[model samples]
Target: MGAATTRATRGRRGLPWLVVGLWVVLLAVAAPFAARLGDVQRDRATDYLPASADSTQVAELQDRLPGGETTELVLVYHRADGLTAADRATAAGQVAAVAHRHTLTGTPRGVPSADGTTLVYPVGSNEPGTDEKKRDAFVADVRRLAHGEGGLTVRAGGPAALATDASGVYASLGGPLLYTTVGVVAVLLVLIYRSPLLWLVPLTVAGLSDFLARAAAYGLNQAFGTTVSGQSAGIMTILVFGAGTDYALLLVARYREELRRHELPHDAMRAALRGCGPAVLASSGTVAAGLLCLLAADLNSSRGMGPLGTVGVLCALAAMLTLLPALLVLLGRRVFWPLVPAHGSTPVARRSLFAAMGSSAGRRPLTVLATGAALLGALALGTLSLPGTLKQLDTFVDRPDSVTAMETVAAAYPERSAQPIEVLTPAARADAALTAVRDTRGVADARRGRTGGGWTEITVTASAPPQSAAETATIEALRHRLPGSHVGGPSAQQLDLRDTDARDRTVVVPLVLLSVLLILAALLRSLVAPLVLVAAVVAVWGAALGLGGLVFGPLFGFHGTDPGLALLSFVFLVALGVDYGIFLMHRMREESLRGSEPAEAALTALRTTGGVIASAGLVLAATFAVLTNMGLVPLVELGFVIAAGVLLDTFLVRTYLVTSASVALGRRVWWPGRLSRAPSAAPRRVPEPVA
Candidate 1:
């Protein structure tokens, strides 16, 4: 018997080493690919556009012109007061020098603003073509050469310059974003575990998962020419840490409970997996499914985000399920150190905080449910205060040189468009297109600029500022008036972004809800329970967005809401909110399966899972909250909404509202399941506690 026991001990030790060995191999193979992920990230405006958008077609066609995609810029030379002749000469000489230095499309044309304090020079070149690197370099060199002196302000602003600045911000986010997220998760884990060694295991595994996610993303880009925007990549990293850590917490909590009941570490680990594995798997599946529904989105960034997010979640799930358990088991019970759970220990028991809350909720279920719903509804009304669609200039939290220059130009030249609308028509219809463009209602100026590869490029200047309703209408009118010609440019791109985001929300929202509902129904085998979860999450989403409306504009002083915020935030909130719901509901189902009364089961489930779920919620919310400190408004807005939604879902929805609803509905919550029917009178087999 001793020999057999020794052999079993050896067998138990063998599996963890094998798991660690496999991961080491995976890390070695994946490191090189992961490091190269940043190299493949694309942040160009067109990268985010819908595949069939007119602006997308314009971008594609321009890449075929003689010089390829044109890198256009407006050099705004301004002074607060009226410009002197010398200032004018300085601008002209600089423009001349720029013209001499590069192969410009035409001599830089100086368009004096009506205020006379600003002189704008529109510069164009195809030399940089479709290459983002060359284009950024060109913009950088121009900015260096045109530096403002004395009272003069010389700034490089336009679509190309704006793109470069935005890309720069995206590129810079990798290091800070990663470090902040890691630090956030680490601190949270340390506090939750209170064991120096225990917290490190899950954190380390999550780090490995991030590496694996990056490597997988790089592979996707290589194989499918996937659009890996900086936004999508950053979001992917967030998911890896946020979702991964949440899974780790759940596993660790269960393992701790199992350790107190089981003698051997191996047995404890196995039991722990049985306790929480299904819930974790269901939560991860729900997140991945909801994200994958982005495959139906027309926008390139949104579509790519679906896969990258799925990769992040799956990688987290894989690492948490495998490496975390293996590491914990290998380290044995001592990993918990000062707080170790000794074998077969039954200590003094007391009601936990969640237990008290659940008891209160159970006592007055309908009142609690109605009150929570009312609060959420009131918050949802804040959506009415949300600002209009954000303009490009307001994308960043801190204004870059391009934004400053554009603002200056707008102040100086309110009546004329500083940026031109680009239209591409078939070479055969060039004259007719030009005539139609000039005759358009808001046309300030129309000129045929370049003709090549069967297409004619027409530059039409609008009478209003960029992204204004008037300018939007003008572009639409041009599109209507110019048959067979594609109207595009910077303003056109923003319009397309707004329109496509709206369309994507309409399609993807329903799909996400349906997929999540299906997954929950399959996992729990209850139609009513799944509906309740979905409806709760939907309320959380609305309340969260409303909270953003109250904060983003009034409290935070943001200019406008991002065009993609609605769709992305909806997907994340609904999907992630349901994760906690699954945790609680899964536990509730387990109790009911053990023949406990429905109301009793609801309270018991909350008592058992509530603390861990709260920790998971805080960790997830805090990790995403890191983005609120990011420089981009879109990142901040997205982070705020998701984080706020998570908090609402966690402390309010899952804690109070869901519990109340479940207790009030009783067995009907599990309609069609065996547990829904009346309990039979038989020998009562009390359920063993998870511990």
Candidate 2:
């Protein structure tokens, strides 16, 4: 008997090392592919467009044109007071130099403003083809030549230049975003654990999970031609750390409790896995399932993000469940030193924060519930204050040279559009298309530009400034008049994006709700409990968006909201917020199963799980908050809203509203499940078993 026991102990001890070794090998194989993920990431507007949109068709046709898509730019030279001969001469000399150096499409001519304060040159080139890198390089070379001298300000602005600026921001996100996220997670972990060694285990495991996710994403991209955008990729990284760390916190908390009763680290870990495994699995599944619904979206960016984000969540789940547990067991009880839970020891009794909260909630459940609901409703009204859909110029938090140039042109050329609307037509109908374009109302001028691939390109300048209502009206007229021709440009793309986002919301929202509710029902085995969680998360999402409206314009000085903001925020908040609900509710169910009274079960569950859930929430919120530092307005908005939503759900909704509602409902909360049946006359406290 003694020999058999010794053999069993040895086998359990060796298991963790074997698992760790396997992970090391897996990572080694994945490292090379993961390193190249950033190379394939694309942030171009056309990359995100719906496949059937006119703008997308134009972009595709342009690739087969004579120039393989034109790289266009406007060189703006300005002086506040007025332009002198020297400034004009300097501008002319620079334009000539640029034309000589690059393969410019036509001889450049400067068009002076009526006020004589600004000079603009429209430059176009097809030499760089459709290669983004080459196009960016060409734009950069042109920018270098167009420089400010003394009073004259020289800037480059156009579709190509703006793309270069946005890409630069996206490219910078890879290194800085990763480093900042890691630093934030590390500091939070240190504070939460307070044990120097204990924090490293989960952090390391999460890092590995992130790397694995990247490799898998890259494979998906290469194998299935999945569109991987900068926005989607960044969000994936955030989830790996934020959601991954959350699962780790819950498991560690349970393991610590198990350690107090179990004699060995291996036994404690096994028991811990059994205790919290279902909840962890269910939570991760809910997140994964919710994200997958995005595949229904018409927007390529949103659709592609679905699978990639799911990969991140699943990888994190795998690592935390397997690798994290193995590491914790291998390190032994000493890993949690300075506050170790020794074998055979019972936890010290104290008045926990959750207990106090539960008491208040139990006393006046309806009142607490009403107040929370009211607050959320009031906050949701703030959505009305949110600005209109964000424009290209206002897309960045920090204005780049391209945005400044475009703004200057818009101010200077109020009567004429600085941006051209591109129309592609069949070569045989080129003359008819040109005639229709000229006859169209609101067109300042229409001219044939390029011919290739059996198609003719016509550039039409609207009488109104770029993106103005008049210009949009003119675009609609052209599309309506010329049925076979495609109308596109930066302005047209934005219009398509907004329309597609509206369509996506109608389709994806209900699917997400259905998916999450089903997962919760299966896990909790109750209809009311699932509905409560779903309803709470839905309220949280609305309130969060409403909060964005209140601050986005007034406090942050943002001019407009991203088109996809509401839908994306709803998906993230509801899916991620339900994570905490699962933790608390699973505990409450366990207590009820052990024969605790309804009110007692709710309070006890909160007391045991509250601290861990709060800590996890803080980590997740802090990690997402890092996105606020990004230069892109969409990223900043997304980060702020999600972070704020998580905090609100954690400290307010989950802690107060959920607890109170559960207490008020009691066993009825679990109606249709066995737990809903009448309880025994006396409560029974199940004794802890020895391992």
Candidate 3:
């Protein structure tokens, strides 16, 4: 018997190393692919658009045209007071030089402002084709050569130049975003554990998970033709660290408790996994399900993000559950250092902060619930203050050269659109399409361009500035009049993005709600409990967006909101906010299963799980908040709202409102489940908890 016990101990000791060895092989396999994820990333506006949109069709047709899509740019030479002959001569000389170097569609033509302050040359090139790198190079060269002498300001602006700047911003996100997120998670872990060695384990595991997630994302792009954008990949990275760290925190907390009761570290790890595994799995499932619901969206960007985001969550979960546990057990309880939990040792007796909060909630459940609901309702009203959909010029937080150039052009050409509106019509009906474009009310000029692949391209300039209501009206009229033609351009693409986002919201929101509701019901086996959770998350989302409205314009100085904010924020807040909900409610239910009455179970669950939830919530919110420091307005807005929402949901909704509601509902909170019928058995004596 002694020999057999020795052998069993040896086997237990060897298991963790085997787990680590397996992960080493998996990591080796994933590393190469992960390095190549950025190579496949596509950041073009057309890449994000639905194939059915008119603008998307025009873009596709242009790619098949005579020169494989045109690279258009506008060179602006302006003097504040007025232009002199030397300035005009300088502009003309620079335009000629540009034409000499690049294969332009026609002779360089300069349009002078009525005030004689600006000389603008519309430059078009087809030599670079639709290759992003080649086009960026071409735009870069033009900017390099087109310099102003003396007081004249020379700037480059147009679709190609704008795209180059946007791509540059996107390309720069991967490194800084990763570094900031890692720093944030590491600090939170250090503070949460207060053990130098202990904080390293989960952070290392999460990094591996993020690397694995990138590899999976690359594979998805290769196999499924998934559109991997810089934004999507950045978002995937955020999920891997944020959600991954969350699971690690919960598991470590449980493992520390088990370390006190069990002698062997391996035994303690196994017991901890069993104790918290269900809640963690259910929490991850809720997030994965909500993300997958985005597959129903018509917007390609949103649809493709669904699978990639899920891959991130699942990878993080896989690493934390397997790799994280193995490493923790292998390191032994000594890894916890000063705060190590010794076998048979009692934890320091102290009241949990959550206990006090839970007590207040239990004493006046209805009043607490009502007050929370009212507060959330009031916050929701702030959405009315949100600015209109963000425009291209206002998209970036830091001013890009193209944005500055465009702003100058908008001021110079106030009465005429600087950007041409492209219309693709059947080659056989070219004349009719041309006629319709010319007859459009807001069109200042209409001209026929290249014809190929059964389509004819017509370039039309709006009498009003680009993206103005007058210009939009003209495009709409052209679309109505020329049914067979596709009206498109930069402005048209923005319009399509807005309309598609609106449509996506109506479809995806309901599906996400249903998916979350169904998953919660399966996990809890209770109708009322699932509804309560779903309602809580929805309220949280509304309040978060309302908070955005209150600050985005007045506080942040943003001119407009990102069109996708409503849907994206809704999905994230509901899914991630429910992550804490699962942690709290699952614990509450566990207490009920142990024969505690609903009210007692609610308070007990909060008192126990609340600290871990708070830690996890803070880590997740901080990781997202790093985006606020990003260069783009959209990233900042998204980060601020999500981070704020997580904090609110963590301290307010999950701790106070949810606990009070559960206390008020009692056993009926588990309606139709066996617990609703009666306590499983006589009330079991509760144990002293580390939390």
Candidate 1 C-alpha error for residue 607, in Å: 0.4
Better of 1 and 3 by TM-score: 3
Model 3: how far residue 337 lies from native, Å: 1.5
Q: Rank the candidates by TM-score, best first.
A: 3, 2, 1
- Kindly report which residue pairs in candidate 3 clash with one another: none
Note each model's CA RMSD in angstroms: 1.9, 2.0, 1.3
Pairs of colliding residues, candidate 1: none
* TM-score of each model, paired residue for residue: 0.97, 0.97, 0.98
- Please write out the lDDT profile of model 2 over residues 1-691, one tens digit for every residue: 9999999989999999999999999999999989989878877788898889999999899888876778899999999999999999999999999999988889989999989899999998988877778889999999898898787899999998999999898887888998899999999998988898999999999999999999999999999988899899999999999999999998998899899989989899999999889999999999999999999999999999999999999999999999999999989999998788999897766677776887888889899999999999999899999998888889989899999998899888888888899999999999999999999999989999788889999988889877668888998999999999999999999989988999999999999999999999999989999899999999988898899999999999999999999889989998999989999999889889888888778877777788888999999999999999999999999999999999999998988899888988999999889999966435655333121
Measure candidate 3: CA RMSD.
Answer: 1.3
Worst 10 residues of 2 by lDDT: 682-691
- Model 3, position 412, has a per-residue lDDT of 82
- Global lDDT of each candidate: 0.90, 0.90, 0.91
**What's the TM for model 2?**
0.97
Stretches off by above 4 angstroms in model 1 are: 1-5, 680-691
